[model samples]
Target: MMRHLDPTRLPTLHLSRGLVVAGLLGGVATASGIALTTTSGWLIVRADEQPQIMLLLTAIVAVRTFGLARPVFRYWERLRSHDVALRDLAERRTGTYAALVPLTPARLGARGRTDVLTGVVDDLTDVVEASVRVTVPAIAALVAGVGAAALTALVDPRVGLVLAAMLLATAVVAILADRLESRSQAAVLAARAEVARVVQLTTEQADELRVIGGTGSAHDWLRAAHVRLRASVARQSRGRSLSAAAVLVITGASTLACAALASTSGADAPVRALLVLAPVATGEALGVLTDATRALARARACARRLVELLGRTPAVVDHPEVEPPSRRPRGAWDPLRRTAHAERGTQGHPLRPHGTPRLELRDLAAGWLPGRTDLGPLDLTIEPGERVAITGPNGSGKSTLLAVLARHLDPTAGRYTVDDTDVTHAPLADVRRLVAVVDDEPHVLAGTLRANLALAAPDADDQVLVDSLRRAGLGTWLDGLEHGLDSRLGTGGLGISGGERTRLAIARAIASARPVVLLDEPVAHLDHPTAEVVIADLLQGAGERSVIMVTHHHVGLDRMDRVVTMQEGVPSHGQERVPG
Candidate 1:
């Protein structure tokens, strides 16, 4: 029963000094309630007597003190507990985000990865919130129950024995309620996750679904998910309802027993009145245990889900030497970027073998999933200073090959070497540092224009950045910007056109100064003239640099030094280099 209530498996939990003070304050507050109830009872009985007001003074003062202390202590407890929980939540979120960096896109599902990541944040918050909801409340109830039993025993031992029996019964009810809640909690959590997934999928893919006439199917899916969520929540609430009813029944029965016992006692009337109210007060304090149990069940469910998701082995692993800090310097394009405006050469990438990196693929085989090979079992090579174009139909594994080349996917079999150094199993960080890839889909971060460009070349001065942009043909666009490099872009700022965004991505690739530049359909969205212009600018900007471009379009074939067409996963014919 206790195992189901623990949430220590959550990665982001941090225990702070405030948590202890909160629990102690909560317990003291509960004790104050019991004291207030017992003292009020004494005051009522004393007032009924034909006695002087002075005789009732102490009881009145005690009642007033307990009443005042209860709210004050409770307020302090709430403040402290929330402070600790929020701090723990912040730390946990930070650590979880850090841990997720390595597991991105590959281990995370290719579809709806954003939704899954967003849901993890909400789940982590619930687990952290349980410190206040479950732990502190249970501590308060225990303290109040113990204090009530002790006071009753001092007045009459049999009444204390009855109170203990009542507490035990309450514990039994709590355990039963927890079991019921736990049974439903997982179902509810899974339902909520499904709803989140469905909603995000519908929202993100609305256009695609509409184009394919899947709008009705998507609506049906979302509706079904919502229905299941509603049912799951209703089922979970039943346990809470049962818990509240049981607590009330126990309170009533215990109060009656306490009153009967007090009537038979030879103790003074005022003491007996105090004894009678003790059971009722204790029951009120224990009623909050239902909320504690619900919190425990919810937190446990969230933790269990996180445990399963986070436990998966990562798709990529770093080699031993580069596992801690990357072998390359932390700087962007470290050991690569040059002081000059050159995109590639000895001035760039000092680590490049003889100042030019050779990428060779010998029978490389890899896939998106296990047992499904999509690329290779064939050999290919990108020689130094070569400009190569690969043209293939859809599903010919062009993207998969690029994924392998970029170190986003590992080769399942065969050798992939860089400048004669076999890097099939090299640290991903080390391999990625030597290659620059610009795929069809580019991301524009929400930041200043300079901030967006700086990601690819952090140390690049304004002239270098401007030069790269000019080479990518963003020269006209730059001239129109009032803020120049400082212009805010993305959401509530300058909206970059598709052509401009494509040019911006090209500029980033040029500015990166990596030894090898691999472009995958860089002109996918451009018209023929724009495509020709962009491709011409690309070849001119990449003097002496190794460039491997994969494209389905045929607008700029003349500029490529060599062109190879592929069918299935293999090169259809011999690689053909254009006449000099």
Candidate 2:
């Protein structure tokens, strides 16, 4: 179980430190209280008709010291423990989000709804609460209880034996109850997850449900899920209450047993012993049992959920021995190195002329999923100073082919060469530096406009950004905005139109100044004239740079050096190229 759950993977270092501090403080407070209670009990017992004031003074001093220390220590312990719990929850939440980044839409879609939300939020919070609120306190109580029992035993074996037996019974009961509770808790969590999934699915398909007139069916499904969840929660609550009640009963019985044992010892034995030992032992035992049971249940639940999340393997794995290709000087090597090399000598080609194609795809077969092939095992080449238009019907795999060239998805079979280097084996970062892709829906972060543009090229100056925006036909739009470059844009503020957002995305891609630029439907939302102007600007602005554009519009098709049409997942060409 520990191997599967791997608690070490949890981001709990700071939380652990706080819990340790709280535990230590609690231990000190508990030890002091037990020592005071014992000392006071023994003194009152020894006091006879000729009682000395000094004895009373000593007892009073011990009691006063314990009273002063207990509350202060307990307060600090509670504060620190809660601090640890909250901080741990925050850290786990952050780590879960970070983990989701690399997994993308795939892993998230596979996970059950309740599992993702609860594991990242509720279950992680429970783990921290279990450690600090339950586990640490239980440990402190056990330490104090054991010490008190030993002291009592040394004074009177009968009293000590009674205390020890009662504690053992309580521990056994708690362990058994915890086992039962954990099973119920796991069921409750699973049920809750099912409910969440059903709710999420309903919300996501709200339009479909309305269109199909199946709202009533969706409501029935959600109601059933909620009923199951409530039933599970009720069972878990019953288990916890039952365990708590059993602990209380056993504690009361233990107190009675201690009192009876003390009575048989002697009439001379002090009543103060009963007062101190009975309450302290009972309280400590109950505290320990209650906390231990809660901790055990919560820990088990959290561990199981975390295990499910971290168990998944990444879809793509990098080869350990792969090395990045050396960066060539910008203007030194011909941009179309592969074409130049092919035209010259196939073997040991040297001194290729400039103005050659920068990127080439040789018999590249690619797909989004495993079995359904999108693009070809077909040959294609783009030379420097060339603008190629890739026009096709929707679902014709234009974006998929562009994605392969951008190295976003690996080809099912075939090779993509960049500057005569096989990009399939090259580091992703290296490939990204050579190619820039602008998508239809650009992700605008919650920040100033300047910050959003800076994401693509961090060091781009205001002038460069403005120039790129002007070239993309966004300069006049920016001029009318209140904040200009500093305008806030994202979910809540300074809403930009869809066409303007696309233009800004183009500006961002152009800011990178990479040799290869790929755009997917960049002008889809723009009017006819505006789109034509933007397309013309893009083709002209990208002079000496290889550009592959996926579009349905034919407004500027005459300007392109070549037009390739894809039909039924195969390229039907205007440019003469065959599968190599």
- Counting clashing residue pairs in each candidate, in order, gives 2, 5
Candidates in order have lDDT scores of 0.79, 0.69
Per-residue lDDT over 1-580 for candidate 2, one digit per residue giving the tens place of the 0 to 100 score: 1112233365322335677788878876787776666556756576654477775777677778877887788888888787867766676666666555444333454675445755567767766667776656666777766766786777667777777776787787788787878788878778877888888788868878999999999999999999999999888888778877777777677777777777777645555364336545445535566656766687767766665665555433344554434444555543222332233232212212253336778888887666978788667888765678888898887887787777667777888887677775666666656677876556677798889888876866777677667766787988988888888887677887767787778777766556678888888767898788877777665545677888888867777778899876678755633232
TM-scores of the candidates are: 0.74, 0.65
Clashing pairs in 2: 336-356, 336-357, 357-383, 363-377, 364-376
lDDT for model 1, on a 0 to 1 scale? 0.79
**lDDT per residue, candidate 1, 172-272, as tens digits?**
99999889999999899878888888887888678889999999999999999999999999988887898899999998998888889899998889999
Span of 10 residues, lowest total lDDT, candidate 2 = 344-353
Positional deviation of residue 46's Cα in model 1 after best superposition, in angstroms: 4.9
